[model samples]
Target: QEVVKRTPGEAEFHQAVREVIDSLGPVLVKYPEFGEAKIIRRICEPERQLIFRVAWQDDKGEVHINRGLRVQFNSALGPYKGGLRFHPSVYLGIIKFLGFEQIFKNALTGLPMGGAKGGSDFDPKGKSDNEVMRFCQSFMTELWRIIGEHTDVPAGDIGVGGREIGYLFGQYKRLTNKFEAGVITGKGLNYGGAQVRTEATGYGCVYFVNEMLASRKEGFKGKKVVISGSGNVAIYTHEKVTQLGGKVMAMSDSNGVIYDKHGINLDTVKLLKEVQRRRLKDYREYHRSAQYTPNGNIWDIPCDVAFPSATENEITGKDAKKLVKNGCIAVGEGANM
Candidate 1:
């Protein structure tokens, strides 16, 4: 209640805080010092937040402006390390929610990193390559003043991927006059990017689910899986799951969902999404027998394993109920979108 009162109108951020606080009830009781120090209150507030205007020209040479922000939420552990999301839905509350979660998530890793998140409300979809590059240039023009190799490192999230990262990194290099590869990640392999970085999240999700299954004396062999989003995470998850003997029947995007009862072909998916940057509808062009439902719920399909690699809050109560009714035994958040 106090947190919500302090941060009014940020319902999502308040909810995130409440969820963590509720889980920490036992911990607070055990360690009264946390309450004494008012650590929770401090954690709720950001260390620094920079909000700037990102103005760029479109393909028609028409100038437009959008809000850009970066939130450095915590640094008690180490330097801030997180991803920069670019999407039409990004806002301060959403960024704060993600950053606040990142703090504890980083702490759990025992890594040399704290927590931060940055992004813009600009939609990269349907934009020309030149327009995207120009937008990235404008975005980094201001962001470069705050980030560094040993200070804050940013990667990709949601709309920000290899293409976006390359543009941002190129602009950073041009502005800073140095090739600091460590300042950003998700770079192309021609540079210093890790080969597994693209596959890590998808593969990591499968591994986590595998561990859970292993604990119960089960595995991915012959399990029916449905993964949302045909992006890097979903495609790689499909690949890895298929390799592990799981049958992936469905994948989706913001537009719609595609259900292939015969299972997805990884090579075709990769060529369509990764190489051509086409939508999930294009998947049907190759697999004419598969079904594509526009703006449909992927969860409605029956499955044993469900991996959501799409947006936040995509699986609502009704969706969960559908998944439960369909006998879904395991669900993994394979990507943050």
Candidate 2:
């Protein structure tokens, strides 16, 4: 039925869907139970796709508008679960990829969740806090009606964080007139958020590496590590790595990388990232001992471990080869690789 509905202009979309469906053909052929389950025939189509216009007022009192989307791809296994990204790079294609990937990721986690994703093309950077709050509230106003604890649960991703989640959840509660604790997962601790939830992804990566090393009677103790990005994952990764007795050689942002061979002072990194909300380039002004390599490649630095805690495809085949050649024994992907 989905194939019959495809048109020539949707050629690219059809091709992508077909590729995924084709990949499942082998599995269905190998397992008669999967065929009995009718999984292959239902592989590519999304359960629901929502597109809405988000209009809000800027700090200047100028009316601004943007498109918002929520692709609730599948919910056969459980309720919808994914992140809300806000960036100019967002589009239907990108949201589909993210939602599709979340299905398998959730399955692997052994959590009661199915695939879904949502976001807008609105960039939160350089905007006033009030402006951001207004945008988040507007986004949530439409989104809350379709999501809930047992229905759908959204979390933080990319441009969405504690601030964004706060505004979103506040708006949700105000509109629904109900305080559902599990409606969102990344809320502040005082508001029923789990401890270490913010650091879960990064810290879990380190923990997995530690376990793998223990299996081989090795560890990260006294080893030099280089981590990319200055977000929550990167900042917390630097913290856990240093706590486990490893020196983080460098950290980077989209603009460039910062090389601090002595060690990336965790507190100072947090100050530059969390407190100041500035770019990684600003780290140099405070910690002069740390070498600031503007617009540089972080993988070029020598290290025993490498954590790419940034965006998708940030580390390519060439970056992998460089890490291997530089003697990096362990690599972790905090976000999409």
The model with the greatest lDDT is 1
The residue pairs in collision within model 1 are 158-337
Off by over 4 Å in 2: 1-26, 35-38
Best by TM-score: 1
Query: What tens digits encode model 2's per-residue C-alpha lDDT throughout 1-337?
Result: 4653843344434545566676777777789898897665555567888988899999889999999999897898899999999988888877777787778788898978998889999988778889999999899888888999998888988888898999999999999999998988889999979998999988988888777767878888988999998888888888888889888999998789888767888888888777777888788787788888778989999889888887776777998899899999888778763
lDDT (Cα) of model 1: 0.89
Question: Cα RMSDs of all predictions?
Answer: 1.3, 3.1
What C-alpha lDDT do the candidate models reach, one value each? 0.89, 0.83
Residue 89, candidate 1: alpha-carbon lDDT: 85
lDDT of 1 by residue, 1-337 (tens): 8877877887667777888888999999999999999998898889999999999999998999999999999989888988899989899888888888888888998888889999999998888889999999999999999999888999998888899999999999999999999999899999889989999889989999999889889999989999998887888889889889899999998999888889888888899877788888898899999999999888999999999987666688889889999999898997542
For model 2, state the Cα shift of residue 85 in Å. Answer: 1.0
